[model samples]
Target: MIHTNTAMKTQYHPISILFHWLVVVLLIAAFVVIELKGQFPKGSEARELTKTIHGFIGQIIFVIMVLRLFARILFGAPEPKNPSQALAMLSKVMHWLLYAILLIAPIFGILYFQYAGKEIHFFGFTWPQLVTPDPVMKKSVENIHELLGNSLYFLIGIHALAALWHHYFLKDDVLTRILPKMKGVRN
Candidate 1:
């Protein structure tokens, strides 16, 4: 049997951690396809292929995010120990902003593609049309989606910097909270 206090101690659920890392992998793949997209000549097979892969991955990321959100709420997360009230509020705001971007960016991409008269298909699976083609709307949504996708690097960098700050300077569990546990070693 476990004591209530011991059980209450903060630790991320294993499944959540797994999903987190999985999302990281997907994010990397998404970035790779997008970054390499322009390398291929315009209207080339490689360019089209990369775009398809990127679209598929983007959609997958959104679906996984939905699952991650559900799991996060269901499993709960380690409560934070903020050094200051301001920092605590900042932390919450940053997190929600990241979540918002993850959810919104893909949606914008889907809408953009549909309006651009591009078929949104994953492998052989087809996504039904959402709206009639509109070059104006497509261009607008494409720009926003692309911008948001690129912004992930900056946002993720800030998140990592904060984790390092906590680990090296504040000497807190902020970073370790999401780190995998080691066997026969101090966690």
Candidate 2:
């Protein structure tokens, strides 16, 4: 499937699809792990384990996002399946917002963790402290962090709905284009 020309891609670059699914799985894992934290006592080992895993996954997501951004810049995207300019513009805006959110959310987590005077460890590696402790700033950043993180539910829902509409209603190639092994639908 190697081609000399980038535009010859029938769908997204294979690497792009890989990054997309990896981030999706990681994001889901982070959300589920965070939700389960409440089941454990605040100071219990289980709670700490859950938080550690969630934060680690957040960092992983951030790394993957950086790579994904570079891939997008270097490889570019497959041509849009939608024909309407208005629809295309809307899609672009949604995607930009998604990227912005994804990039910012993890940064917020790291900053909040540091500001809260907690060690930010990911995997076996320790993250460098980026800010000094400040309770007021910590509270504010955590609130914004929580707000942006929660907003993902709505934003992702819209993205999924749009893809579904394109696939089932408009019967276009929008969804299939990003799917790793799915064949793009012919017009």
Task: Give the top-scoring candidate (TM-score).
Answer: 1
* Clash-forming residue pairs, model 1: none
lDDT tens readout by residue for model 2, 126-152:
878879999999999989888988999
User: What residue runs in model 1 are displaced by over 4 Å at the alpha carbon?
Assistant: 1-9
Model 1 lDDT tens row, 1-187: 3223423658777777777788789999999998899999999999988888888998998988898787777777665557898887787778778888998999998998899888888767888998999999999998999899878889989888988998899998888878778788785
Model 2: which ten-residue window has the lowest total lDDT? 1-10
Alpha-carbon error at 146 in model 1, in Å? 1.4
Task: Pick the lDDT winner.
Answer: 2
Per-model root-mean-square deviation over C-alphas = 3.3, 3.4
C-alpha TM-scores of all predictions: 0.90, 0.88
